[model samples]
Target chain A: MASKFETPQVRKFPIIPKLENSATSHLSPFKSKEEFQSSLGYPGELVENWQEKAIDKMGDLLGKYRSLRVYLDSCIQCGACTDKCHYYQGTKDPNNMPVGRQNLMRSVYRRYFTLPGKYFPKLVGAKDLTKEVLDDWYSYYHQCSQCRRCAVFCPIGIDTAEISMAAREVMDSIGVGQKYCNEIIGKVHKIGNNLGLPEPALADTLEGLEEDVLDDTEIDVKFPLDVKDSEVLLVTPSADFFAEPHVDGLIGYAKVFHQAGISWTLSSHASEAANFGMFIGSYDNMKKLAMRIREAALELNVKRIVFGECGHAWRVAYSFLNTLAGPFDFLDPRYPVPQHICEITNGLIDQNVLNFDKSANDDMTLTYHDSCNVARASSMGGIMGGQFTIPRKIIQTVANNFYDMDDETIKEKTYCCGGGGGLLTDDLMELRVKGALPRMEALKHLIEEKGVTHMAAICAICKSQFSKVFQYYDLELDQIVSLHQLVSNALIMNKKEV
Target chain B: MSFVTILYAAMFYFAAAILFIGLAYRVYEYAKIPAPLKIPTPPAPMTQKGVAIRIFREVVFFESLFSATKWTWLFSWIFHLALLLAAFRHLKYFTDPVWFWVSFELVQVAGHYAAYLMLAGLLGLLARRVFVDRVRYISSPSDYLILVLIIAIAGSGLMMKWFPSDILAIKLFFVGLLTFNFSELPSDVVLLIHLSLVIALMIIFPYSKLLHAPGLFFSPTRNQVDNARSKRHVANWAKRMESTK
Candidate 1:
């Protein structure tokens, strides 16, 4: 589907645009149909008493999630985070601002729950839960990627991501579901992966990948599936099996395992590392998805679990997995119960066991884009800022030339790929293009000044999103490469002595 | 007691009750709610002591805000620090014999001058709220009014320096209110207006955005330690789901 909206022009330097009301109001994604919603255990359409149901859901979430409750009350309108959101910067929509988006729900929270808003709504800027307010919530909440960048800047640590998640959860409860997220979540529940790839298809895809690796490197690298008693169970996003640059990353993971001589297998039961449950703010759904990994680990008797390159998926796996589905005391306790592939590869690099042919990646100058979730919401190697460092350490060791983008744009303050938090569908192509502006400006400057050739990222969404949005900025689609894709290029594989 | 004294005394008690009780309830709610996940914003502290230091920096230095925008940080830090000093200086009214530190020559001098800095900071913040396009867009009526209310309180309190209210009588009235004994409050117009505004602020503190003071400490993103993988963190409500599984 072609976008009716114009792509926001990338500026020389990223500057905060003036306030524009309702700028992205008409940019909402397609709503989930009855089947999609019902599959997720939500109503088929808008509930008859959606207003009351939404309010009740909000109250329930306020009691349940501490982030939502404290964040709603903590914002002092200090505007520290006013210019921190990528959507706001790109779209120039006031409602896209973290605080502006939060206020849409905050106003309703005040009206129904707080004293001042209850008696004096106008004075506090609280509003009644009318059709227009709900519409605004549907439109603006989807705009936020739940990136958590604003929380880093906020004086009180009031995360708009938390509020946006809660808002999404409330919408889901009221039979108002986003087609992209809800549909993906339902597919995960039904088919064990976001792509809905059944057991035989997943095995066939792995077999094909094995033959491709053999054809290229002439190494009998195996992509085993459901292999019992494997030492490691490799869980990755379904896109890794289907999409470009992403599938290349999956091949990289396979090659690493092949070199390290570690027994690893992909489970057909829990094939996806990307948990859309977190995007919808459904605890039950999130836990259900996580439990699949736990069950797969137990069923296969894998001693360790390693997650592949996915941004939000890493956050769920690293931060929420322990709480959601844990007591992994059943597995080996020597390593982090659920480790990242980067952690594994970095560990092997530290041990000096993996050799690299750095000249293989000399064709391009590379810089890494710190995917938002991995940078701010998750960690690697049990160290502070390890997520940013470990990936770069790998790139430098495996490749010849490397440069970082602007200091502010690279680390904890990294921009979202614009397609995260379940807004990656084609209907939202315009938003994805505009939201890529901040990142594109920095990347373009690096390319022109430093003579950079390719930008590598660890996230599946970042890979896909940049591949699509790069064309609009006059950059080549191939400029976006996977972190492990670089690794695959430079990795020196030793052939089996058969 | 005269009607003026009685009315003012009643208002003070009422405002104080709301301030303390309402704040206590809010704090209790915050404390009781379980943070189901470890969501400390990274590069976060890995240890409990490290988390303590992180929160300390956030509270004392406005560390996050400082990194975000220097102007907002400057105004906000100035206002908050000055407000602390001014609040400490006002404690002399309630203390029968002021604590030695409160009356220390440097503190007494600095505390008296803090009022000016506080006013300046408030004005800077107010100007941003009214002038900055992004800030102005997010500001509600109450946001501006909250600043105006505090400015008025500070202004009238400063006015007493020129108008010369009976300080001894005012102190006695506050002390009387603290105790069971009742006394007449000096009815200086500036003093009366200042006290009334102070009372209004106290009444609205918990119900208003001022809850940010306590809310900051309770924020999971700032207060949580980054050891999610090392230990299992399950809340009571979430634990129920585990049992069912």
Candidate 2:
């Protein structure tokens, strides 16, 4: 099984350094640019030299000291991930290839930032800064939807999406960020969400949506906000107030909570979980925006935080909340636990408090589209496995047809909807549509060969991207619906509660 | 200095310095790109388990490169391999004896054929850049300029090898210069051309994308992994909810 021609080994790190408190005491456990380089024997003087030139270097220093540095020092670029990314599969342009995309920002970042870099530039293929390279950085970094699907395929877990985010952040630090990414981040800072919708405007939008639900279903449903002493604080993406398929998912979350009799209220101060700041690699911005949600929850005295179906927001909730803002006491030790809508539905089912009639969606065969963020980068997926249990269970209870996509189409290997990392922007629609090819190719196969009629998605972004892909690919529009949409349609809600 | 030595030294100092110096500048420029360092950097390609498979696909088999363009790969492979051989063979001057006995055979063959191949490859790459609209569109002044200088270096090197010249004396003159002991030198026109081209390469080495060779190791793409879950495992507002400390 082994061919003889082999490459030399990289110098292995000795446990001695990690064990020696005298030398390694300063090393942080998590990945940090400063720690990784310091471990790599990079002299800190290189950074100090640059700091001397620039008076306003504190922010840059802290940013570099954070986990970003570890991410910067570790990529080897074996190109094994080429076939793993749905974007690459969709658009076969070598530029879109994950490794090539990572290199677009990475190679240049190394020369200016690392130690051996200052001495041996050519040995590493580092080039000097130019306006042209910056331009290329923007074009390619944005080209990444930040879908972590490729991460699922990496051997050592190199996440190309992280590279794209870091590239955008570096550009933003240098005042070179895209109008789209930076503007959204600014709005998230100034207002509550990327749309810059204030509390009054947000209330009006939700009240308007409640009225729409009443008109459609003849049921009076209120979307509550900023109520004190609630057991749960629910946060939804700002997109839900205006966006279509996402609105249905939001409605689905509301109904699931309503049916379960959970005391929850939305917080206008922290209305959205779609932290676009994350996409730009601004950890401070992400923390600032996310902290507001924490503040609202603490002030509201909620027992738990139920996050609506938003991708990156969920990622932040699941991945970063504990580390940056941790050891919560005001919250029930178990309180402030963020739950996916499916999790709530699944919880209701497990408690035997929910009933279902699958006949409503029986006309079509349903296939689930796993959102890239939830599937790869977060643990909420197990909840999906739990929550999605009900729709099928209800379908079986009512004798409806249910099927699945290809083996690779489910779980961690799920294809991205091609609009992740906020490519749903009008400016990026062409790129999004182009990048959707690989995922669509797989979906098209299911639609045509496997007789898949409806694609059930849990995340709002997936619903949005799938709808666009369905439209472009000339598939049925109604076929793409959120799991909640199906739940609302098929749930056996008590007539008295309605 | 003899006319040949002076002319060769003058030209090589100019050409090699321009080429290599410009390249160094380019490398530095690449490092200055506005990119954050949060992305993960992986280990050396040689360190990974599937490295052999990857090397086969990437370097030897030319899988993706072949798909990009057959001719680009052809020129690139020939240029890289010949340049590597030339560099290794030049090690003959650095040590008492050449350490790469295996590669020495390839270097001997290169001494015979690398000059013409490099000229052809560089010219082919240069022409392809000019004639092919796509490559031309991406090709910068430095990219084309680097190719021209490389052609000159290989050509001068081949010319010296084929022609009977006091190359040892010329080599010693360069050694003395490197040791900071510049003195009288042998008269050789071709050696001067090669030296100038080599010098030109050194000065410009820091300014280009070629710096990516080192930058790649520092790049987050090779290092960072998708560990968002490890960070996000806690519920929102857990601090406020708990806040015991």
- Give a tens-digit lDDT track for model 1, residues A235-323: 99999997988999999998999899999999999999999998888898899999999999999999999999999999999999888
Instruction: Provide the lDDT at A394 for model 1.
Output: 98
Q: Flag clash pairs in model 1.
A: none
lDDT of each: 0.92, 0.59
Please report the candidate that would top TM-score against the real structure. Answer: 1
How accurate locally is residue A378 in candidate 1, as Cα lDDT from 0 to 100?
Answer: 95
Q: Write model 1 residue lDDT over B1-245, tens digit each, in one string.
A: 78889999999999999999999999999998888888899769999999999999999999999999999999989999999998888888888888878887888778788889999999999999999999999888999999999999889888888988788888899999999687789887888899999999999999999999999999999999999999899988887799544
Off by over 4 Å in 1: A1-3, B243-245
Which regions of candidate 2 deviate over 4 angstroms?
A1-74, A113-123, A215-218, A381-399, B1-245
Write the residue-wise lDDT of candidate 2 on A142-211 in tens digits: 7777876665454334567766776665554444445555556666666778778999998898899789
Tell me each candidate's TM-score: 0.99, 0.60
- TM-score of candidate 1 versus the correct structure, residues matched by position: 0.99
